[model samples]
Target: MWGGNDSTFLQGNTNPVSGQVYTMYHGTSMEAAKKIRKEGFRQSVAGMLGRGVYLSRDLEKARRYPLNLQAYQRVVLKVEVNVGRVKKIDKQGHPLQNIWHDHGYDTAWCPPKCGMVPSGLEEDCLCIYWLIHKSLSLAGVIICRQTKHLQGCMG
Candidate 1:
């Protein structure tokens, strides 16, 4: 997850399925680094949800055995969802809406009339994270709650 691409990741880190892990220290501005890490975490969780299985991106030891893998996948999620937006509440645990509102339609199939979208900047956009997270959860896929702190998840 730390590496930018699959090749770099394979060169530096062991294959996760091999039940191995290594720590790599980094020296960077905390603020910037946190942003990158948060994004990576979300993407990683999305990968797991998409696969319908819980694979540890940070800890291979966690799924080293069949029993562990089974137990991990047993933890399912249950929540509501909208196609391209969240409920009245927001990811920050906010009580109301109209403040940070997400507006768009799902491009699941890149349907007609769904041309390129301009998501120019995360800081200037509403979020679709809660909707995605909730949908995944309702399907019995649980993502980390810690990801709510990510920049693109607050709305």
Candidate 2:
């Protein structure tokens, strides 16, 4: 069964519980970006939301990822994701925090500034069962080049 909406998860571009296709972003190292373009995404073994491909609807949030990398080494991927059957894991210690997929959710979402993320930005995790075109697909890549002014750098 699909998850129902809660007002708290409705602050972003698209409602997490809507089960609609929305534009999202994934940040990575330039090297990883190349590999992803050629080989596609792999679900993370674990994370804040756990065992899924982490993404975000917020461009700024996406730009801050692979956190250790410098701007010049980072790349943000534009993607389209069909956030089907979402489960809102808004709080830091929510029972389904890392295992929403096991509860029949295709995606797990944490809303921005909800204190779940240190950055306080929004985050989404697509379950391994819904990888690639079945739910997520690449749209484009934004390469961050460090300039004298650090213009257009997302790092």
Candidate 3:
């Protein structure tokens, strides 16, 4: 996800994926470097959200049903974005997630009115981009919780 038309590349002491890691590289142009940075950051955010969602779904189900898989709540709720750490709560706080999912909009086609949009976006690119990112984050928290629980159970 980190390529552009510029001659510069993203070079630094810290790894782009991990805020704590470090690295160094050369970019072809300043523009290229910036683009790389942005793309890297975007990928990192996306990865985090994916991880969070995977955890949250399990944790949420467990929390709501209290280990009674047979009594698990069959909620038809639209997926929410799990942005950083997630709390074991019933409601999500993101407005975009609420509006898009609850209102029955095809998020992939959401538009921003911009002339050009990222791949997978047919309409509101910007809004959809942010919404997707946030939703992933929200889901990620649950994934984290689920993983932790699984680890505990296994240990």
- The TM-scores of all predictions, comma-separated, are 0.19, 0.85, 0.15
Q: What local lDDT does model 2 show for residue 67?
A: 83
**Which residue pairs show backbone clashes in model 2?**
none
Worst 10 residues of 1 by lDDT: 117-126
Extract clashing residue pairs from model 1.
Answer: none
> Alpha carbon lDDT of residue 151, candidate 3?
29
**RMSD of model 2 against the true structure:** 6.5
Give the winner by lDDT.
2
lDDT of each: 0.24, 0.78, 0.23
Candidate 2, number of clashes: 0
Q: Report the alpha-carbon TM-score of model 2 versus the true structure.
A: 0.85
Q: Give me the overall lDDT of model 3.
A: 0.23
User: How do the candidates rank by lDDT, highest first?
Assistant: 2, 1, 3
lDDT of 1 by residue, 1-155 (tens): 22332211222122222112212111123342345344521322232012112222222222122233333222222122223431222123233323323233221111112221122101111134533453322212222222335411011
State which candidate, 1 or 2, has the greater TM-score: 2
